[model samples]
Target chain A: MVEVKLFASLRTVAGEKGFLTDAASVGELLREAAERYGEDFAKRLQIATVLVNGKNIAHLRWKRTRLKDGDVVSLFPPLAGG
Target chain B: MIGGYMGKVLQVDLSTGAIESYSLPERMLELYVGNKGLGARLLYDLLPPMTDPLSEKNVFIVTTAPLTGAGAPSSNRFNITTKSPLTGAIVNSNCGGNFGVFLKRAGYDSLIITGKASKPVYLKINEEGVSIEDASELWGLDTEKIQEKLTAGTGKLVIGPAGENLVKYAAVFSQERAAGRGGVGAVMGSKNLKAVIAGGKKRVPVAHKDKFKDACRKWRQLSREHPATGEELPRFGTSIFVNKCNATHTLPTRNFLHGSYDEADAVSGETLAEKHLIKNIGCYGCPIACGRQVQLHGKNIKGPEYETVGLFGPNLMNADLKAIIELNYQADLLGMDTISLGNTLGFVMEAREKGLIKTDLAFGKIDRLSRTLDDIAYRRGLGDDMAEGVRFLSQKYGGEEFALHVKGMELASYEPRGAVGQGLGYAIGSRGGCHIAAGYPIYLEANGPITVDPLATTGKPGLVVLNQTTMEAVSTIGCCIFSVYMFLPKALLELNARSPLISKIVRSTFLYGGNIIGKALSWPAWTLPVPAPFFMLPQVQTHAHCTGERYTLGKMMELGKRVVSMDRIFNLREGLTGADDTLPKRLTDELQRAEEPRSKVTLSKMLPKYYNFRGWTPAGVPREKTLRTLQIEEEPMLPQTAMGAASTV
Candidate 1:
């Protein structure tokens, strides 16, 4: 099982903070999460970036990236301030 | 000549109470563009050598660009330019409101105010005429009340008690929006001017009517296509970023001593919108509609922006939304810059904790914050100390190591610990720690598609310089930077249509569908003229399906460069030597490890490189050659040449 955490606007769509996902692939995980959430969650995923251990998931492979037990995944949209 | 402007400049002399109208010199308009650029040139020309910022010698200008009040999306922003009482540098602060668009409709590209008003007075301009009216009745009133007393017609800009009292960090407000930084309000107070009530119905003139209309439609489509700006910003507003920043551990807290706040959710834009939002407000022709409307009591009020959420929310150690909202309202009413005030108050609280002062003004102390604000606005008790600004307070109280400021002005909400490049921008900004003046480092570090070490000083100098130059141009052209994300792809297509240089680049990206090139091009799109609220394009289209008119990029960049260089010249004239461009001691020396988990700022390492990148001497002085190239004369020997005598460095 993998733990996925959603934040900011993504959380508003995800409804819950953390969820358990047994899916092995990133795409399957997202598809399952979106099914439980709403169409907005799927739409937000296009802009909603995934972070693994504080690094962006875009830095890794997209849907093909495999998930492992104990791996922490976080979803976030862009936020900037100065 | 045929396709770019409204063609008129309005000069109002408060001293003699004279109103003069002139067709703006074509060359000046072409080169300076409007807002930041034009205002700088006008101020450089009009201001006497080394004139006191708060003296009768200073001039306060509100300027708009050709794009103002047009149907162009987010292109109607206006700027207020003056000498700053805070850092004694050239101060130009812009705000998104109805005033800029109204001012453009009043048939003037700019309004230059000089001399002292004989008494408490306000200036009213409309299609009929312009007059200086007595405003004793409006004195001591807050911004909401003052704005209420004015004619409900479009284009009224007013100052509140903070400006009237000459608070150094006071701001000039229009409706609920404010020209928040640079002490523009203090200059108004110094001149005994109360407020400016203006409205006009003149149509904004356009260049290239056919092309501009087509361009507008394409631009609108581009905006709707961008996921971040078109959807996110419009839905959640800037406060939406609050959660993102906190999640990344970059949300500034407790006077930038920390990057993440304990109660980030309480002040997040999502929370604000979900809990308190009554309505969403848009500036001029903006499609994003990010402004917040919240009900505090029975009356609706403008909610705290992102900076306010960070500064008053976490920086002050206060998390309750109601407290932040009330304080935000109070500051707005007082015409005070909430960012500066909150930062200053944080310094006081820290000082008190250290026993540097004999007060109990600790973090989360709502009473102290309230008392301090009243004091600063009225220049009373501890307020007098706070009014001296964070830097002076630190100096007097012996906490110089923890003073959170750059060039005397306090830093905005983002903690430098999370991003060193932003710290560099603050230190080197021409307008004393302004974020918008040059905030590229933050973009490069956190929001960019490109990856960079946020805590490193490398590459920051060049980045800061590039952002500053671009911002200077954008300000002059009179547009909001927020539109850059949404409008960039369209801007590129428009530029290619206008200039061959842009076409060559567009052809190189044939491999990636238009969208990939669109994202890549957004990085460099900072160079183009941005659309603002005050200056509206004559006609604008919203999507690819519609036809908007076209404008030239070459002309816009030229005007932007002119505005940036002119402001530099103004600062040089004001005696801002290399010594004046410096960060506060806190960022330079104090270790904020407890609050800021990853705090590491070495401003000393970057200042030299910044100077080099700016074509300045090793000492950080603008090179004589660079100044001459920019058409800025050498400092004129400073009368008896007592230059750098009072320099903090």
Candidate 2:
């Protein structure tokens, strides 16, 4: 099981702050999430930052990066400020 | 006057009650531009080196840029450059307030205030002349009250009790916004000046009226189109960075003992917008409207910015957003800088925890905070020590290692360990730990449209140099630095987010491009002649159109470089050295998380590279060749005695 946390506009789009899921990898978790949150959320996720264990997934293996039980995933829409 | 300037600068010398006007040399205007750069030049020339910041000798300058009142979006801002009692270094505080616009409208581009008044007084400037009015009734009033008591339909800048008591971080309020750092309000209060108000019917002259207007319209449209400035900022305000910074392990928590806070999301911009925000507000000509108006205690008041929220919330271990909101309002009304106030309180809390000092203040308990703020403002009890600022308090008590300040100014919300580039920024920032003066490099390192490796020290120096130069040039031209958010446009962000390979390429480009940009900055300004594309950097285009000057990206970069070097000279003159470019031991030696070995600011690795990139000596002093290249001299002219006066007060 993995804990998925959403922030910024992503939380509002997902209709929840977080959820517990049994997806085996980042791809599995996100594909399932896309189905649950809808096509609009799927589109939004294209522009959202996905972090696993506090590390940005872009530096990881992208969606191919694996997830494990107790691993935490956080998603944020692109943001900027001083 | 070419354009935008009122062609006169009022020099108000309270010691002799003389208000004189002088037309700044045209070469100086072209070289320094206006606002921060101009103010820096004026301060450097008018006040002797090593002058006491709180003494009658310190000079206070208020300067507006050409775009201040020229109907440009995000361009109506003013700057206050003065010697600061807090760091004893140069302080150039910029504010997105209407005072700059009104001052321009009142037929002056700048005001130079010097010396102390024998009694409490306020200065009024309008179409007819200037007056130093007795301000006994306005004295000791809160910022809001004093501003309210002022004449209506005019721009006002006022200080409250914190300033009057000489609290080191006291801020001056113009409307609800603040010129909010480095004891500017204390300088004002030291002069026994309660307020300064300006009003008039003068119109700002634009050299190319039609072109300037069109460029401004397009600039506003562009701001609305950019993802960061238009959508996210307008919707979330600055607090949106909370979740992003937390995810990146850059959020300051528990007085810098930790990075992420469990309660961070509770005080995030999303939470503020959902729970407390009444509406999004804008400053003067700002189209981004990142300011927030929130509901507090059945009344609506100015909401805390991200700095206030981060430092007061997670840094102090307080999850109560309502408390932060109330404290933010309280700090503003009391006319103290919330950034410094928050850091000071956090230091005290940790000191209390370690038994280093005895105080009622503690982390996660804010019950006494309101009264504590009052006490600090009034300089009563332990608040007297707190009024001396974190640097002084730590020196007097114990715990200097974790005091969380550089050169006396408190660090901003981004805990530097998680983003080491920002750590370098804080260390070498001209104004000593100021986020803006450090060029807001956290944007490039952590939460920008693109992200570079947070732990790498490879190209950070060059990146920091570019960011600082860009931010300085933006401020020099009188635009809100938020407009630079469009430098990373929507198309690039969407493309970056959509493709992992492209994102990698973009990040690598910035990472390595930093080195190239840094090297390029050392080359003669004339070597790069291309104007940045209008679509990409509309600010340069708008400035050229407004002022009818030939402005390219090269000139803008050069202007920024000149300002940076001038500040460095000013600091060096004030006895600051390369040794002063430092962060607290807590940030340098301690990791944000024990498990993350790379989560510490490696300042030593970046400092030499930064100095080299700026063409400065390894000691961080500007070389004589560089000074000559920038045309910064040892002296500039100031108006003489009474006859130079356009009118006397």
Candidate 3:
């Protein structure tokens, strides 16, 4: 099970804080979450930043990065302000 | 006449209670655009070298851009340009308030205020015209009370006791927003001015009403669709960066002694929204609604921004969110800049810990802060020296090494050591240590989701220049700087996520292409005739339509370049040299993280390259060819008034 967290607009689309998924990789987990949410959520996720245990998947293995039980996956839409 | 402009510039001589109006030239409007650009141009021409910033000889100008009050979203920003009482450099403080909108309604593109008033007075403007009225009763009052006493419908800009008492970091308040940096309020107080009110029934003229409306609608839609402007900002406000910055190790802590805080989440935006937020607010005609109103003492009031939170909260090792909210409101009512105030307090705390100064204000001690803040506003005891700001305190005491300021202005909450490019920005920023003026490159370096190597010195000079030029252009056109966040659209962020190779390539492009981009932008407008994409910069199309002017992305960027050049020239004439463009020793000489050998900013490694990219001499002065290309006068005109021998401090 992978623990997923949503932030900003992604939270609004998901309609929940996050959920647990049994997907083996980040891409599979995201696909499952997208199905549970909707096309809008998937569209937002396409542009969303995926962080696995505080590391951006872009710096890791993109969606192909493997995940295990207890792994915390965070999804965030592009955010900026200061 | 431009559709958005009132076509008049009002000049008030407070010494004689004389009011004069002059026509704003079409050529000046085309060249400078408006707001920051126009204000800089006016200051360069009118301000005499070496004139005391708080003296009657100094000129104060408040200006609005063409989009202001033209019903453009987030376009109500007004710029206050004056010689800074704190830094002695030209300071242009921008505020998001209704005053600019009402000033446009009251029939002026800009207002030039000079000469000290004979007595306490406030200037009133309405459709009936302008007049200087007695404000003896309003003197010494808090900002909120003063605004309440003014005419109900008029837009008012008022100062609190802090400004009246001439605190070096005093701020001017309009509604709840403030033009809150570089002692602009002290400049107002020095003139014996209390407030300025603008009210009228007139509407800003539009050149092509249909086209202008269409452009504005598209721009608004773009903002609404963007995840940043549309959702994140409206939901979380600017304080949303707290957790993000903390994650990136960019949160300023312990007087910038560290880049990360152990308990940043306790005072984070998520906590504020869940525990305190009453609702989100916005400036006039703003779609983002990025302002927060939090419930405190059973009443809702303006909440702390990211800068205030970082400086007042984690910087001092305090995690009390409620206390920060209360302090934010108190500071606003007192008309003091929270950024400077917080930085000053942090410095004092560190000084006390180091035994350099005798004070009970220790780290994480929150109880005495409220009283200390009040005392600083009223100039009581230690508060008096504190009111003089960190520079003065460091000068008098022995904490020069940890003063946490540049060019006499306190650095903003972004701890630069974490983002080396931002450090370079703080050092070379025109208005002392302003993050916005420095282009806020930390968004790319650390804060934003997509980022570059935070500790790298390579490619930073060009990055800073690019960000600075783009930000200056955005601000000059009267739009909120937040609009620039959408420039990196959802598609780009998505593209980066899909492929690591693409992300690296894109980041490399930004890093390496920066020098080429900066150099090309430094050239004259004719050399780069291609217009910036409307989707990326909707301001150009909207401005062109509203003013009936031939505006392009190249022309807008050129105007921004010219504004920066003129400001540098003003500083040069005022006697500031290249040596002044530097950070505190703590940022450059000391490391933020022990293990990360490159935690300190390599400012020397970047400055020369930055200068070259900007087409400036190695001494950081603009070259003759550079000035000619930007259409600025090669040499500044002689001071109209007798300026004594320049003081090179």
Candidate 4:
């Protein structure tokens, strides 16, 4: 199980700040979120920033980055300001 | 002479009641350009070393750039440059108020004000000319009240009670917008001036009118299409960074004791947009309209930026967005800077908890906050001391270890430990702890679409140099810094999204190319000709069109470098050494999290490299060769009035 958190436009689109899901990897977690939310969320998720436990997965394992039960996965879609 | 210039500068001396119109040199304009750069050069020429910021000898300059009123999007801005009472360093406070447009329209390129007024007075400038008017009644009024008392149909710059009372962190107000840092407002008050108003019917001429128009049109379109500038910013405003910063562990919480805040989302841009926003607003001629207008007690007012929210909210352990909004408005009305104000409060709250001072102020306590704001404005009780800013408070209260300042100015809202590069930036920043002046490297390290390893020292110094040069260059011509967001167009971000391999390549390129970019930046401007391939930076292009100059990438980078070098010399003359560029021990010695031993700002590791990239000695003085290359003469320049005629610039 992975804890997925959302912010900004993603939170608005999903209508929830975060939730728990049984996903073994970063790719599986995104698939679950995209499927649950719809095409709009999926399109955004493709380009959104993914951080596993405060570390960016882009420099990590990308979609293949494994997630443990306590792992916190945060998703942000092209955020601005500051 | 280039177009987009009024070509005359208004010089006023309140002591003798003398007003003169003069012109700046063409060489100076070409070298420094305008706004922050122009103002920095002007201050260096006009002021003596070690002059007291609040004394009659301290000079105040108001400068506008070519794009100021040339109908360029996000290009309407002005600068107020002076010595800072808070840090005793050079301060150039840029603002996006209507005053720049009005000042330019009134037929002047800049205003140089010196000496103290004989009495409480205000300045009025129009096509008729400039005059100092009696403002005995207007004195001591809040910012909103003073503006209302002034004549209508004019752009106004006024100070409130905090400024009048000589609070060190006082700010100048131009309508809802503020030149809100480094005690510029306090300097205005010291001169016994209350307000400066301008109105007229002059249009900024364009050298290449059609080309300039087309460039601006395309620039506007590109900005509109950028995800950060067009969508996220419009929807959430600057406070939108709350969540991102929090997630990245960059949010300043509990007096810089922690990096992340548990309740950051509650006071976030999203929350403000969802709960309190009345409408979206923007600065003059700005297309993004990133300013937030929210309802506070049934009256629509300006919203807080990320700085105000982070410092007032998470920094002080307060989570009430309504209270933060109220405090923000209150601070503005009082003519005080919310950044310094918030930091001072955080320090006091933490000091009280540590038994360093006896006060009712405590973290997460909101009841006394509003009254304390009033007290600070009026110089009453504990607020009086707090008004002096964090540096003074720490000195008196015996908490210098956790003072949370760089060279006496409080740090910005970003907790640099989360991004060591930002820490390096803050330490070496010319103005001391200002986020923008630090080149905002946090964007590349933590927030932007393509981020480097936040904790890695691998390529940070060269990267900081590249970023700082570009930022200072863009600022010189008067474009809003937000416009730089389009540097990463949506197309590239989309590519990064669809393809992981491309993302890796993009990240690596930015991370590794920094050193090469830094070296390339120092090349001669003539070497890099026009038509910089497919992606010409929108700013350099629009500037080239606005003024009939060959604004090449190298020339623009050189201008930015010269601006920084000019500041370096000024700071050196004013008694600040390279050693002065530093952060507090807490940020350097202690990690934000015990688990992350690498999370502290390793300034020593990057400072020498930064100096090397800057073409400065290890001690941080620009070499004679570097100065000559940049055309920065250490000797005080003869007045611009002596250099040329009204048609000069």
Better of 2 and 4 by lDDT: 2
Model 4 Cα displacement at B437 (Å)? 0.7
TM, every model = 0.85, 0.97, 0.94, 0.97
**What docking grade does candidate 2 earn?**
medium
Model 2 agreement with the true structure over B378-458: per-residue lDDT tens digits = 999999999989999999998999999999999999988888999999999888888888888888777764778888888
Task: Give me the chain B TM-score of candidate 3.
Answer: 0.97
Model with the higher lDDT, candidate 1 or 3:
3
| lDDT tens digits, residue span B1-649, model 1 | 5233555666677777767666655656555666777677677767777888888878888888777776677788899988888878888888888888887677776787887887899888877888899988988888888888888876778788888888889999887889999789989988888888767778775654665676676566666665556666766777876766665556767777777786888888878878898988877778777888899888888888988888898888888888899989988888899888988888887888888987767888786666667778888877877776887887788887778777778887777666677777777777877777654557655543222446656566656665565556655666687764432343332343333343334333321222232222222224444543211222222211111233334333333444555666678767777777666666666654655444677877778866665556777666666555444443332222111111110
Output the worst ten-in-a-row residue range by lDDT, candidate 3 chain B: B640-649
Q: Poorest 10 consecutive residues of model 2 chain B by lDDT?
A: B640-649
Q: Count the backbone clashes (under 3 Å) in each candidate.
A: 48, 0, 1, 0
Q: After superposition, how far is residue B247 of candidate 4 from its true place, in Å?
A: 0.5
Task: Kindly report which residue stretches of model 4 are placed more than 4 angstroms away from their true locations once superposed.
Answer: B530-536, B635-649
iRMSD (Å), candidate 1: 9.3
Task: Name the regions of candidate 3 deviating beyond 4 angstroms.
Answer: A1-43, A50-60, A64-75, B634-649
Model 4 lDDT tens row, B1-649: 8888999888888887878887777887888888999899888878877888999988888889999999999999898999899988899898999899999889998988888898999999999989999999998899998999898989899999998899998999888899998999999999998999999999998999999989888888888777788788998999989988998999999989899999998999989999998899998889888899988888888999999999999999999999999999999999999999999999999899899989999999998999999999999998889989989998898899899888788899999999988998898888888998899999999977778889987688888888898889889999888888777778788887666688788888777877777677666566666553223379888988888988667788888899988888888989999999889988999989999989998888888888888889999999988899888876545464533321121
Best by lDDT: 2
Please state the error at residue A30 of candidate 1 in Å. 4.5
Give the backbone clash total of model 1: 48
Over all chains combined, what TM-score does candidate 4 have? 0.97
lDDT of 2: 0.88
Report residue B649 deviation for candidate 1 (angstroms). Answer: 33
* Interface RMSD of each candidate, angstroms, one decimal: 9.3, 1.7, 2.0, 1.3
